[model samples]
Target chain A: MLPLCISHGDLVKLFVIALLATTALAVASLFVGVSEISFFALLSGESNEKMLLVLGESRIPRTAALILAGAGMAVAGTIMQLLSRNRFVEPSTAGTVESASLGMLAVLLLAPDLPVMMKMLVAALFALAGTALFLGILRRVPLRSPVLVPLVGLMLGGVINACTTFFAYRYDLMQAMGAWTSGDFSAVLRGRYEVLWLALALTAAAYFAADRFTVAGMGKDFSTNLGLDYRKVVALGLLIVSMVTASVVVTAGILPFIGLIVPNLVSMAMGDRLRHTLPWVALSGAVLVLLCDTIGRVINAPYEIPVGSMLGIIGSIFFLSMLLRRRSRAA
Target chain B: MIEFSGVTKVYGSTTVVDDVTAQLPKGGITSIIGPNGAGKSTLLSMIARLIPCDRGTVLVDGLDVARTSGETLARRLSILRQDNHMTARLTVHDLVAFGRYPYSRGRITADDQAHIGRALGYLGLNDLGDRFLDELSGGQRQRAFVAMVLCQDTDYMLFDEPLNNLDIRHAVGMMKLLGNAARDFGKTVVVVLHDVNFASCYSNHIIVMRDGKLFLQGSPREIIRSETLEQTYGCPFEVQELGGNRIAVYYT
Candidate 1:
């Protein structure tokens, strides 16, 4: 009735395109490695014992981890944007991942013998609390420009990271905390990488919460007028966001800017149809992280750069370019 | 029928709407006219549940507005505030389509589409449906907001300063639209307006407010007199008969 632009046909076409692009990036991620496993020898698997281990255990899981982490972060960003009614909010931008990292560090320091799920639960609780605190501050401090909200969020995140760093340094646990926050994919082997599948489950929960979030963005009165319990929607959104952040933190440390960058690009292209944008944001996010991970591996041939470091450098440059373009247009 | 029983809203030490009790009858154009800081908008917001009353309750067709769920009241009543600023980049069609959200929740059905098309046609916005709200003039945007309220298709419609940015022609068109909605569609229309001439000309029932109290309520013929207008607005107003309508001339 409203001109079904993304009908079944258009949906199939866009998804197929997204799937093909992501698959290409995934294959590139596997073969383009920094180790001594040349492509010819890895394919043959005939004379190289160490190459098999790198190919089977390391490359495959890392690529899978990249895709999983990217999709989870992008979906989480979309939900946060819808919930807060701000386009620039992402898990990392809003201090969600940093808070979760702090929680994980606490678990490592305090309860090192706890189960992996328990540690993740603690991290999720901290991430949710952090997001709630940020939103509360947003309500109290009225921002004139949309740009100021994200900048405020970034400063808040910096504060949280500063606190985490100070404690980690004091206790001589800086090395452990550093590894978790820098996002190294080299450790995402078979046994350690199952936590990322939880993100796939969170993606489904995100779809269920998208409609409620859209209504909630219309203002508290309007959402209540539409029969949506605003507090419940906000809580559900925070829970999904926190869980996604915790899983990504526990699995691959911190992947910067995927949550912030990918969703903005998808919204620009596809409009803010959550039903339509969710899948595309996920696929594009996976592709971007995979591409970035591959580039990081190829750029420094022997000793690889961390994906988080590479994303920080490249993503910030791209984000700054976008900001300049927007400023020029406004001028 | 909508009833407000001793609905008093107090802001801090100040009472904005003080002990206001009134019953607005069904199926007529009722206009509330008052001076600045008379608590007209505050009263309207309390009735629409946009602002909660501290002391009393409002009932819309016998359903307690405060106790009933917002969605339930939303089906029977709709309100358009003075400011309708949107953060999203939306076309006129997109803005109007949100009127159907109470029913379709953004998934537009055939019935919803029909209502949207009709509202657009009624408001003479068929051509401007695809244009952005920012691209239109202020009067056109006002008309678009009114069209959204009409598309909502509720039994009770409330508007606060609906003609704030309209020129003379568009203002008359808006008053005529509200009048027609009340007369033809059997809907109760309540508007808060500063223009006494428009209220005198179009409204069947009129209420005058002063200093956060309902000072007078009656037919336009009873309340649109020179003395009442003078006392309510604290300005000189000459009530003159113009083309079988009571016209309050206060432009001096």
Candidate 2:
């Protein structure tokens, strides 16, 4: 193994570089769309009301939602990985997103008149319960191999997704379920995406508690030896992960892989100290989502591909390569 | 002083530690030695409050370990388990800095920094402080853990099989380090040792366990006799005195 430790100065420098890249991507995402919103026209003060309306309503909110969801999901993934002590475990694989989808479906069928905020809360509660169940199952399984954890999570996710699909088909709400499950930011208006701001707050809270999560990652014995209440920290971590998953799923649908890929890549390079690597993870996640969303918009100019499909294709490749690489190295 | 009266631990109908009641004197090195499945580690863990006792009371300086707050017990005692597997990728310095968590709570103060530096130097890990733990040798990693325990600066320190994957030189060095800590700092050092010879040579007091019970407790001179060793280990043993230390030589 190479020397994986980097100085604090290098970490800060890396963070700056990542921030700049995310900013550039965010700026680029603002301009790429079906409508022609040129930078010069906006800056020239020509008073293009229609273009201003498009920028404010569609472009800005979409970009903001992309950034918030990206950062929040990635931070949530980091916390989940630490709490579970397994690198492969994330919200998407751990049945959190599927549970949130189920909650959204329930709300749509039972109380269609409820506000979007209430829907998000319902989804968050369901997500929390589902994640707790996943943890309970994990505790029962003999964790002799690291791969067993994510396998159990993926199996749980598959079961929940199957139930969700069956319910959608039975209730004849398949189209609505499709809209909730596919991650597309095209319909994100100004008022529609404010729920994602809660994800932003949760992400910040995760950062503030990063040190505790890092200590908790060392395992229960280490935490107790250090005088920390391990159970409380793990509970807070699970709550943050569920809420972030629910908010993102509610706002723009399920963005897979951002939670799994971003944190793994960041920790591979920067070590697992959350206080140092979390900002990098957040920035990388935002950059990935913004770039993919931009590509999805540009590839089929008039007809946009959903960002969820785009991320699914990209994230699966990363996931496969990571698994293969780990296996080959172990062998 | 650490006192445990009627401390017991049972796992699935088997009493791992059966009514172990003893008093460990402060300010010296005490070694607990026994055969496999004798519950040496379990007793140490109960004293450190790592695992809850099935039924008993453990008092560290008169504060009940089961009732006292973890933070308060942490300030008074520290324990290092045998298997220290962690998912986090931490450098030697980062791992040792966690020792100050009881006082600083993850924020490294100037005093904590001083303690960390001294621990690194004491363990001869000054140059390896920046190295990741997985990149180091087994002996170096063991020393790093000991360095962390030393940096904790507690009055009492408990180690479970501290010499588990080390070479002879490193094992001797670890025992010397523990001896130095007890002599220089007046700290109470308790260790679970597998090698009875090592226990006989270094420890000021010795505890012997068998079949989940305390079989004997005495100084090295009293416990290193041939008949006592045979009774405890159920093997033939020859004891010889060399350089004022009783060495046990067992027949195969």
Q: Which candidate number maximizes DockQ?
A: 2
lDDT of 1 by residue, B10-128 (tens): 88898899899999999989999999988999999888888889998899999988888877777789888887665333568767877787787778899999999999998899999
* Model 2 TM-score, 2 decimals: 0.97
Off by over 4 Å in 2: A1-6
The candidates score, on chain A by TM-score, as follows 0.91, 0.96
Task: Please list the C-alpha lDDT of all candidates, in the order they appear.
Answer: 0.83, 0.90
DockQ of each: 0.35, 0.68
Candidate 2 chain A worst ten-residue window by lDDT: A1-10
RMSD in angstroms, all models? 3.4, 1.7
lDDT of 2 by residue, A112-154 (tens): 8889899999999999999999999888776887877888899
Docking class of 2: medium
Query: What is the i-RMS of every prediction?
Result: 3.4, 1.5
By summed lDDT, the worst window of 10 consecutive residues in model 1 chain A runs over A1-10
Query: Candidate 1 lDDT, tens digit per residue, A64-95?
Result: 99998889988888888877777778888898
TM-score of each model, in listed order? 0.90, 0.97
Clash count in backbone of candidate 2? 0
Q: Which residue pairs collide in model 1, if any?
A: none
